[model samples]
Target: MNRKNLTHKAGRDNAEPVGGGGRIRPVNNPREATKTRPAGGKDAKSTGIDRTRNFCIIAHIDHGKSTLADRLLDLTDAVPERERMEQILDSMDIERERGITIKAQAVRLVYRREENGDGGEAEYMLNLIDTPGHVDFSYEVSRAIAACEGALLVVDASQGIQAQTLANLYLAMEQDLEIIPVLNKIDLPVADVEAVTEELVELLGVDESEILKISAKTGQGVPEVLDAVVDRVPAPESAVEQTRGLVFDSHYDAYRGVISLVRLFDGELAKGDRVQAMGSEEEFEVLEVGCYSPKPTALPKLGVGEVGYIIAGLKDIEALRVGDTVTKVEDPAESVLPGYAKVLPTVYSGIYPTVGDDFERLRDALQKLQLNDASLFFEPENSRMGFGFRCGFLGLLHMEIIQERLEREFDLDLIASSPSVKYEVVLQGGETVEVTNPSDLPEVFEEIREPMVRATVICPKEYVGQVMGLCHEKRGVSVGMEYISTKRVQLTYDLPLGEIITDFFDALKSRTRGYASYDYDPKGYVASDLVKVEILVSGDPVDALSFIVHRDKAYYRGRAMVEKLKELIPRQQFEVPVQASIGKRIIARETVRAYRKDVIAKCYGGDITRKKKLLEQQKAGKKRMKQVGNVEIPQEAFLAAIRI
Candidate 1:
């Protein structure tokens, strides 16, 4: 590889990130920014790698890639059990409760070379990339595979091949990554190792003898898996070729500032050194350097083909993101490495302060979160809901996690809009207007296009009718349907992404008796009329009510959202008018009557302190409300409106 390849692009602008992973702000590693321009194109030059082993874990959800990693750290004595994390969730709180790795997490595992040769003095650095298996987060798996040379595919022996298991294998194959099959969960009584072996051979085209059977739950087969990684995954061409490293990820710690995750292709990183991120000017001292023991370990240096975390003064992880690079002392690679072409976000929502005076607090919480989740793009936004942020995420779950994080992690209350996809209106003049919030829909647009969702649902044949009925209710069209097994059918549909962001999936499953599984990907947009539909009680316009709907169904869904709002909202002293609109013009309208009675029904003469306390509580509650012009919008009003 030409060293100039990594250096030539030093002056060029950092490219955009595309697909489900999405883009983050750029941070140039100072060492990387000074590299000479590449002779050919933007690409990292290879480094010496007698110390390289690249591999990704491919397994269905709950197959325990994280658990296995925990054991790997302990088995290798990479870090004392006191320092290392048990499950490398690297995941936020929401991810753990949801039981999925929303983002692909990478870490370096240092294993002692006792099995292979050289009297076991040689230590092997295993770059372990854990990819998410859920279809919703499949894009994360793609990037994980891109950074690896091989895959340690874990399959449950009793369960054999799962839907996502097959999905991930297909992804791994596309990357041409060497596959080391491992049958896990052998600790179960019904574990059928032979059956799973045959299934793997037939489905993945792997030899039966190649599959290593293990019980990840019991720490079995982990050693063999680690050994296979060293033998099967070839080291980087050269770990000492050049001063090049790839910025595969970044995270922000309140105390550590910027913690950048990188794969060193050549050279090493040390403490008390000045360095810059690959794309931006954010510089930091090598506060600490350690392999992704998921625990902070103070190591002297990291060699090529190793994944490690760098804590710098630059705490904004977005700046030092995936597909970036690191170098020694302002000497970067010829050009920065490319991860995915660029990241594009499809789902969006509005987040606002639910209570008065918490606007700044909510904004602070969101900014703090953006420090870690670079994919969750956000900006200052003012809305009828309140002064807040308009955030973008990879998918609905991505959006939900950030919201949950804001509330749970930061303890700030917020009001959010239902998730929506960008709607592009290709006008007659070949121009397009992108609509995220329904309030942004252009006025009198001739041709409006909104996102259509593509979903694959698995439900029992007996409940097929129930599922189909639910689909039709959401105006989803059955484009294709197939039988996945004797009792299950996979149905494909195209619906508005907005329609199902809320309870559509839940309702589908509930109506079908929990037999339906739903997965969706945005399938572009369909041309339809959308409006800034506002809901009002009595005659007051409640800004919290908004939706993107076709002109045909706008009346019903709009009315439904308003009616539901009425039930959720407490009647006020004044009447409220719930009206739906397109710009200033009202298309449909509804109204909720004012409160007939609100004053306390009984007041005994003796309890003076109790009455004072009740009145104080009422005053405090009033302080929490937002004063929207003449309306004292209740805090619970916004929360109740979009809780789902």
Candidate 2:
């Protein structure tokens, strides 16, 4: 089995058993794992620049990006019908089951025009990159936008324009790429095509005639979508003689080592050519160069304007970063590619091995997983969670996906602490410090500046009041609010990132009946009345459970946290005191009473003095236990206390 299958198997073995009496099969068919090569390298070489078009599909979650990609594959006939499966680009089992794409997948298609058609008889190459839809994976979408010259902006006819759709549209515009607006899912009975088209026209400032209507599920109007891409989307401009390529994505293969998915800009890269990474400055010989025809297909050479994969027999995956530029070792490009932005993690948390002895295994597993996930970051941290790694992610969803992958793919159980946003502290000496964890805050600081974001919520007019109220409760400042259509409204607010990371989305869904869509971008830091709230168990502070909150909400948050802790913690031999405190003063407290036993059950026929003596002895024993014994907190309690 390949490494991917092995990882899937490890996850299945460790998780709860499926409904049936058998293990779930891996997504890829083991029998079809052989290496494939495109039709001919010489033919691909003869293909001209005008015949190539590179673009990506961008939309909100559950808006049919993957389904549209599947239809495009079918139109291009890249993969045979017998071999094709649902969500072919989503190769991971978890993604398939969840109906979401976690990683960006690329596929190259060959489109041949008929002589009798409107266009001349010729063959064209189309490269399509599928991106994740959730806001947490916006960074991935941005990277996808950077690689292509155009994008297919897909929107659900039923749902209309959403928060992520607008975010992606703006990102594509920033990249200066031509966008082809598409209204998908016209086959659904509830799809209001006219309403959606109007919304798109109003929001995008595009002519009504420019939009294409299609149903990715039934393959309706898919050919028209492809024709629009060819006629409207501009081809890549030719580059200089020196070889230049951008590594947009990568994955580790047990059989072939690290394989990089790249878009060639300037020159051609043959199978045996030596190349160096501009960022890491590491040189290696290209063992194999290939393109994805729904599967990895080896090629003799990847010419300019082509999207393909490169295998350099690289043992260290760090050398091949997502945004790094790859060039010929001997004759490098004059300058590296522009728009290479380093991914900075915004959310921080503590991840610990469920079993202490699995530390080495967990570390090695994380290192392996980090090979493909450049956005992931970690460093050793010692806290109440014991010796574990402090991990940083782009957002909460990113954090959850990494944690789940670690548990499933690595065959290890893990515990993750509460997620936090980075805080800037201005010290008394006028020195600035950035703190990822509340325990790392300095004792004396003049001001604490918390990261804020410009959050946008797109919803029906009925939910405007609720959304505005929710924003106000989170200490948000209204930026702007306007009507996109007769019934749809767009509300913008500036809110602290800390508030959004903690159940804001869930609360929004609850109040808006799941009709509201939200997105946000960092707006730098602002001075705030922030205090480090710490949770104490029997008067001892738990560093892992400490968090920063506003002074006005501290008392309420403290009370809620202590009450939750009291309920989650098990009864001990002595009364356990759970307190929420800020520095030396306790804001709220709760107590878990000790388990009492009948110490004088057999003293019914005995004297009253004898029963009293027995009870006294029991009381003394309980006091001793309370003085010396430590509270053994369960893992679930950590999750309960983390919400605050």
Candidate 3:
């Protein structure tokens, strides 16, 4: 390698000749490379001028998301000096372990396709947003989809379309983005392109010609899909005003405080702009303004149709709300932000510390989570299980993920209550109540209106009997059941929102296996004989243990909940009563039998270590629980009962 070659190399790998297209060649002369190599070496791609694109892919899980990304990197020559397929983008630790996308990952690639209508077959940046597929991570999916103007709906040719696939597709449509249907998994023998296309036309109501057949695994049809994305997905029509941008997402950065993910709806973000977001009056001289292709880098400016990150010189994430508008301090944008939707905090749950003294850690985790999720609302609320937070979530999955994240990410043990739906009630004294906790229920008879849900169940016509039976069991009133085709039927029900929420959907699926597809929306509230079945661990009522059920269903519901609690509730030093009661009458009762074996007998040798460990474990366990006379209360005992 000569000095002239080292001049272009700038940092490392002087012996590795630069390819014609500015790609790095494999290191041939180790000595020359070693001599020129900079301290840790530079990112071959990241070190070069960053390629930028703003787009998100929408597909069901297992429709070759990460594989498609892997192929793009290869075809675009994004990887060099390593034969390793290297990263699969979403193949993060959790994703690889679980084989599911838990978070959205961003990356940059150049399709370098025939430009077609844009003058010449040109090279343009392609920003790929790969998101999660499970229902629990739908918020992450929605966030990723919103970042792109075009969504490539990857449908499995073999598996056909799934309920969740349609759910995401409908959301993409609702966002009014261009929909490009790609038939994935054509390499498999079971690939049914025709069947899936027909379903897309009939079920999704998409035009037949709009679908493209592709295989992300065999590296087949991927280029065509890329072409479809460019030709079909329109360029962003209008840029947001001169305002900075609205905070689309955010996260807590240990050193950077809160790093906000902002989509440039309009205007340009310069290096030193002071922006106002939410009600927060922090004037942040923009420390760094660049788009995140999953990897953050400094950029000159972000125009319309760009997704990027902002490092505001502030430590509090609460200042930059997810849905709040961002405006430059001087001469703010005149027009209001576009397509601003009211993201209501729907369900509420109590997130308690199972290990007892991790309350501060729980708050810290929540603060970090809230930095990215503006719609999440949580505050300190006291329960019988000591002090915990009554946290708001978008849905059940949101509640579960937060709990899981606290445990997995923060190493804080948690006991969570069944999610409680927000209720609207008219009190006897003419005051209407919106209650989250069942403990807030009015003791006296009043017009109580629990939220009602409108749900449509798609199932085999022959199974309508079982479906109807299941719905009726949940106190569901069927509007009608219509046959779409020979074997398929759509059943409409106006059921108590509580019924649909609590294990009902899971039960419905269990009853039908993976075949039934259901969709639901909140239908305000309706008057019903609602009562809070209070669960008393011994004589004291555990507010965290209460569940609001219709008077008609309370008896059985309470009985099952109490029965489950009995199996889980720790045995007491003395006999303990776990009972569910409505008003003054006890409806269900279960007992935590007296401790037959809580203490270990004295032992010898290695047995002494086990016995002493058990004794210490028992002592530590006592600190986590409330001892009522002889009765023992487990932190999860109350949460386990709600079943929501």
Question: Best candidate per TM-score, number?
Answer: 2
lDDT of 1 by residue, 511-532 (tens): 8875456655556767765555
TM-score of 3: 0.79
Task: Give lDDT per model, in order.
Answer: 0.64, 0.81, 0.66
lDDT at position 105, candidate 2: 87
Better of 1 and 3 by TM-score: 3
C-alpha lDDT of candidate 1 relative to the true structure: 0.64
Q: Which whole-number lDDT from 0 to 100 does residue 415 have in model 1? A: 71
Off by over 4 Å in 3: 1-53, 60-70, 77-98, 114-121, 134-145, 203-207, 239-243, 278-281, 355-357, 460-462, 480-487, 595-630, 636-639, 642-644
Candidate 2 on 1-644: residue-level lDDT in tens? 01121221111233222111111111121112111323223233464666788899999999999999998998888989899888889998879988898988889999877756767777888999999998877767777776787899999998888888876776676566788899999999989899999877755667788889999999998898888888887776653668888787787887778888888876789988989999889999999999999888998898777899999888786778777889998899877775345566779999999788988988887777877776788998888777899999978878888988998988988888778889999999999999998899988889999999878798989999999999999999998887777778888889999999878998999999988889877778999999998899988888878889999999998899889889988999999999999889989999999999998988778579999999899999999999998897777877766555
Best by lDDT: 2
Pairs that clash in candidate 3: 114-121, 115-121, 239-266, 240-265, 240-266, 574-630
Clashes of each: 51, 0, 6
The Cα error of candidate 1 at residue 490, in Å, is 4.3
